[model samples]
Target: MTNVVIVGAGPTGLTLACGLARQGVAVRVLERATAHADGSRGKTLNPRSLEIFADLGLAGELAAVGRTHLPFRKYFEGVFVNETEPFAGARRSATIPYPASRWLQQPQLEALLRERLAALGVTVELGADLVDVRQDADGAEAVLADGRRIAAGYLVGCDGGRSTVRKLLGIPFVGEGDPEPVMVCGDVEVEGLDPGAWHQWFGPQGAFMLCPFEGSPRWQLQASPETAADGTMVPPSLESFQRLADTHTGREDIRLGNATWLSTWRVNVRMAERYREGRVLLAGDCAHVHPTAGGLGMNTGIQDSWNLAWKLGHVVRGLAGPALLDTYQEERLPIAAWTLDVTSAGMAAVVKGIDTPGIGVEVGGVGDFTGLSLGYRWSSLAAGTPAGGDPGALLRAGDRAPDGPCPGPDGAPGRLFERFAGDDFTLLVLGAGTRPDLAGLPGHVRPVRVEDRDGEVRRAYGVTGEALVLVRPDNHIALVTPATEPGPVHAYLARLGATG
Candidate 1:
């Protein structure tokens, strides 16, 4: 029997498989398609997603493929409007290591993750047509189209918007959907166009844009879909896209060649009522789907898997009971709800700014889109702030732990994220070297004592006095307690079934 049977080999499934595989949990990633998908679906990896890749040890390969510093040049009827680099001000700092967003096609990112998962001793099984699913308190069973049954401790669905696992589970996907398709996108070879910047043309006909990828002949094509007399969207094609480019730019010099892939997107702001049902759970587009305006679709799913992995790993390893799995839904459901609302508003803003020539309108850059501001302050695991902890503290329980300069175990210069990376719950003892007696603590809950020599970590963490910040494996602040008190620390661990 496998520890977990994950349906869908997309980024979310693959990432979860890698996380569990790192902990020696048997994970099977099954994909319905015979091969991996190649598309221009999601192209932006926000700062938070970049941090996740860093933790997975794929930072070097990911950075090499993602392009940053490309300015978006706008055109109105073939006239130069202006140029705005979205991430120009996102500079690296001690607190924020990956401040800039990286632009790469979804296929490229998935390819990198697949390679990493393989290194971790797992491969995605192709053509896995999961037809049915049944679960109980003990475990879940998956039935494939070939009349084969695979039993596992848990099942997860990451199989895109139209998910089979979710359907089999009869989960309600409640949200607002568009009556017709909204946008048409494609990947195509371009001619006579500058690849230095993302060239966009806006007109009364609608919006048209071509974003070039570094070291690739293909560019991502985006345009407002044309509606037919029946009020349905006309499917995207090479010739149809050419017409859109000509109509929007009012120029015939530009040409689109060899449309490799094409797809249409409808306005979908939806979420599963619950992420977990007994031994089965849902994530990624299978759990929630929002507007692509903020480029949060793929990033949110990547984060969802990251958050669920550590919890699921704990349960599979017997370190924590199944109650820990409940937290996965509790924490992620709220985040997904927030994503749907924010992305919907962001999409409305994009439509409102379609006729404007100024670049002041924020599309997918800045603010919460970077994902640094997101936290689980309301999570049961975070356990709320300490009894006497400041309610208005800058860094509170359930917040995404910030990065800052710190000393490593060898007393060498290093960063806090470097210590937080991997499959361990880090108990960061801040202010002074007041390391707690971790003798009876779970092996995964390791302690890190860092003296605030230059006050870098102190300032980033917003801690003025001696404090113990318990960071979860996914790098969220589990709790913050006064360093003088070790009872709360021990009690919290016991709550997590980590008593030694």
Candidate 2:
């Protein structure tokens, strides 16, 4: 009976629920677990994710808890080698406000999102296991394990790598894992180690790492996965961790105990063949998974939810056609593909060179791990994107919209992000010469006339005088055309069925 029934309560599901609930969409988030997930899953939040969280009004909260300048200290046989700051020389301009990444535990991020969802009048329904998903042309029904059926206009699967909804839907998750387990990971208390830096010890055998969590006594311990003679990965334990430390670091005095969230990780890289299946769709790990090296899993999933939330909200609210839902896959599926390739290569590099294996910028195979360069230029929703370039403009349609200084509603100076905030399409009419053909636009479109104050707005967007840029609710550019020729804007809205 709700507009959306989101499966799983991880960061992806919670973000979707928050976006929809904020837009007055009746949303229900069902989680199979009885409580929030624990462990230091995907501790790094990239710059693009910071921008999303900022839009969600979590910038201050995340900054308060996030460590932006954690340095990676390396060692060889427990002997200090060299240290490196991952985000050294990162730039921060008006366009890239959150230029650096932050390290915060996954559970803490989930808690913040859950708090935001509660503020929007929606709570995650835990202890609810989905057994089946059925959908017709009109709506979808989630069949719970306890014989409860929750019907909604649409359903999204945001579950983890082993997604039940995806399996039930028969969507093929095509990819492979390493021949054996790649690493053993857990959160444990380490004695005789500095909790200030990410301590790593590399040897001829393999590499062992223990990253200290902010304001916590426990550290995330990762080491080469132990295999039995029969070739089965040995389960993680404090004793196993101690053995790894002793073998790699020759540190017999250091003790490890109070282990939690123990598990073995593999260099598994897989993605759903498709993101959408009829009225049901998948996001986050439900759609794709990456290797444990770069911590790109949760960030990719959260961005997937961000991309889908607004489109699904529009369709459910009768503001756009069902075809709009197809763009979700068109846009995010390619991103998943890119993430898998880069992260897989990065993991391989890490395994091949353990003595001085690279991290962050050194490891990303093709692009940066910050998730800033991701886009969907091929999406059908990205209308009016020309084949050629404007020498003066650096951005095209479907690019992540950069933030910059501009005039507010009352002609007061403000940033573009303030206008882009909320669940609405921001139509930015820049400069005095731009045309004002705002009639028949959808009610969700918020048109703002900016003076381009001090040329900051134009510089960030890389646009010239008299330009109209339509930004999507997820803060991606939908269309960019000259103000003199505004037909593209109207035509694009017409294609989206957004005309009033």
What is each predicted model's overall lDDT from 0 to 1?
A: 0.85, 0.84
lDDT of 2 by residue, 84-106 (tens): 88678888888788888898888
Give a tens-digit lDDT track for model 1, residues 148-179.
99999999999989999888889999998997
After superposing candidate 2 on the true structure, give the runs of residues whose Cα lies further than 4 Å from its correct spot. Answer: 227-233, 355-366, 386-393, 433-435
- C-alpha lDDT of residue 463 in model 2: 77
Residue pair clashes in candidate 1: none
The 10-residue segment of model 1 with minimum total lDDT is: 358-367
Measured with C-alpha atoms, the lDDT of residue 349 in candidate 1 is 75
C-alpha RMSD (angstroms) for model 2: 2.1
The TM-scores, one per candidate, come to 0.96, 0.95
Best candidate (score: lDDT): 1
Q: Candidate 2, residue 483: CA error in Å? A: 1.5
